[model samples]
Every structure is written in structure tokens, then in C-alpha cells.
Target: MFLAAMARPRYNSAGECTFDGKIGVWPYVEWVAAQKESKNRKRGTMELKPSTSVGKEKSREYLIKYVLPAIKEKWPEEDRWNTIFIQQDNAKTHVDVDDPYVLREARRGGWDIRMIFQPPNSPDTNGLDLGWFNSIQAMFQRKMPKDLPDIVKKVEESLEEYPHQRLNRIFLSHQACMREIIKHKGSIHYALPHLKKQSLEATGDLAIRLDIDLEYVEAARVFLATP
Candidate 1:
């Protein structure tokens, strides 16, 4: 199973807030189970669960309770015996430097599991992130819930009814895309145009400016060192 963590802002519709409105954070934990085939082919299941919390601590607790257990239940029996690798990005909620629950679980499982962290700013590397937001958006479009309780109920219903086969098709497609990316030596930019476009569109204004400034500062340091 490949796992990825993402966050989307929660809004209060009764208060007439924007989609980006912050009623605290709703962190989503997505799990995809893939079965490999010959010649780099693969297909599998996908499960998405939204975990709510007013703060980071509560969020982590929610993941431990609701998300991880579901993942454990769905884990392939053979893979559990073999080396199980859990891949996730370096989100603060996902993995706190001081104490990461996933890592802790891996240790408790007698090192039967391994945790891999993707490179910074590399959401495309994880296929779960690719179609996750679209699924959430589709759910949101169906019914704009009045309050948190309504939103939670709607989200639960969506997850329970989400088609696993469709998710498998998506992962198989992503596996093919990944193979091509590997052929080009992991240059994600060249492999997936749609992912790049989605990533760019998702980036916020302040984040873009900060990234540009950071690049400039790093380049200036390199020039100084050369002199």
C-alpha cells in the first residue's frame, strides 16, 4: 500500500465563507493498494479518509485512530510478510521531526515496515495526490454541507461509496507514467505535463514568491563562493 497525506481547508457555508476559509484544517490520509504485474504493470485499490482536528496534535491523534487502523486492515497479507514500505511526503502533520507516529509504528512492527519520504515540493511523485483533490472537489460539488457535522457526514458517505476499481485504474495508469519517468532518470517535469499544470495551479501566491526569493538567495551564495 502506498500512502500519502494532504490537507484542504474547511469552510463554514452557513457563515458564507470561501472554500479557502479556515475553520481549522481537514487533513486527508489516502491509501492505495497496488498489485504488480510483469513488465512494470500494476493495478489496485484506493481508500481516502479525512481526519479532522483543531490543531496538529489532534490531527495526528485522529490519523492514529481512524486512518492507520483502516490501512492495517487493508494491507496485503503477502506484503505484510514481505517488506512493507510506506511512502509519504514530508508534511509536518504526517511526520514530525521529533516524533513521527508512522515511524514509531514501523519500529513497533519489528521493522517489518519501512517509511520513505519523497523529495520536497514533489507531489507528482506520489500518484495519490494526482487525482485526490479532484475526487474531493467532485464530492464537494454534489452537496455543499451547512456545517461541520453535515460536511463530516457527506465525507464519510463519499469514502464508503468511492469505487475501488476506478482507483485501481488510476494507479495502473500512474504506474505506466512512473515507468516513463524512470526511463528519463526521474525528471518528473518531462514525464507528466498534467501533473505539472495541476501543481502550478495549486500553488499559492505567497509560496511562489518565497520559492523565487529562496532560489535567488541560493544563487547569490554560489556566486559569492566562486569569487
Candidate 2:
């Protein structure tokens, strides 16, 4: 599987995109040189092989080596010193937020990077899982990748080519989903909301965040307070 990190796209004062929000996407594979010549290839040809082990060690390695550095390099300079939260689902392979090595690496360069999990049992709250992955997958499938290396290359291309504005729209949709979750008393059974985002964008009325009714906030508070 490919691992990815992204954030809501950022725009400057004149509304030009400053950051595209694609920290990076990394495939969980390594190149292994063939030991013996085969009909398909000569000996010593390096071939892409999917990782056999994907546990906490591998996950932490990806975060420390790839994700963190990408964020450091690509994150906006103005906000680099501010707290940056890396959100991941509560998969068993995911490192704990407080893993010592992770904490040390996250604290490097005086950047306040931190890790957090998505809301429990609410995978839809993640912008990637909510919409961006689907967008990337759609684009990647259109490329008709023919092999493992091709798949990786196509996926990375898809991610790079994906529009930043569409990504921002997906993040807004994520906020809308969170609002719905609160309105539904933390339930995930509700239908996904549609905002006609493309039309809204054309009209220049697309919102960075959806407004929530005060009553909904109160109701969610009450629900949280209940036994």
C-alpha cells in the first residue's frame, strides 16, 4: 500500500496558491536485485518488491525518514514554527503518538510537530480517506498502469497532477462531515453531504469551512456531557 501525507491547500493574500498540501506519497516497496537470470530479465536487474513486513517499525521509519522531512521542506515558512499535527488512523501498525524515537524526531529543528489519531471509529473524518485518496485513485486508474513500478510512478504522478483547489474542497468536505458527525451525536450512519463544489468554485462561493449552527454545537456538548 502507498502511504501519503497531505494538508489543506494554503493560499496567499492575493489568493494564489502558496502550498499545494501534498507533503508526499510513498510506496511501501523496495528494490531487490535478481540473484539469477530469468527468462524475463538478466541477472542483477533490480526489481520492485512490496514490503513483506508492515509493522510499527516500518511505519515509524516512513514517518521519520520521509514524511517528516517532506513536511519540513514543503510546509510554509511562516507556519513552520507553529504546531503541526500529523493525523493517522488507529491502525495497529501505526506508531503510538508518544513513541520516544518518534517524539525525538518530531521535535527536531525546533519545529513543534506532533502526531494525533483520527476520531475513534470515524475514519471518514480524515481528508485523505474522505475524498483525496479516491481522487488520486481515480486519476491513477486512468493511467492504466501495467506493473508494480508503473503503479507507483502513476500514483505519484496522479498525486502531483491532482488540483490543489480540489484538495481544498475535499478538506472542506471533511469539515462538513465532522459537523454532521457532531450533529448526529457522533454517529457515522448519515449520508455524505454534497456541496456542488465545482459549481461553487466557479461562482467563487466555495467556503474554506462550513458554518455550524449554534444549536448543533450545544446539542453535541449536551450529548458529550450525558452519561
TM-score of each: 0.53, 0.87
How would you encode candidate 2's per-residue C-alpha lDDT over 95-193 as one tens digit per residue? Answer: 898999988998999988878777788867766776667766676567677899888887788778888888787676776787789889999989999
Question: Model 1: per-residue lDDT, tens digit, 122-146?
Answer: 6655544555546767877876877
lDDT of 2: 0.74
Off by over 4 Å in 1: 1-60, 96-101, 109-111, 191-227
- Count of clashes, each model: 0, 0
* Model 1, C-alpha of 7: deviation from truth (Å): 18
**TM-score of candidate 1 against the unseen true structure:** 0.53
What local lDDT score does residue 29 receive in model 2, on the 0 to 100 scale? 95
lDDT of 2 at 114: 77
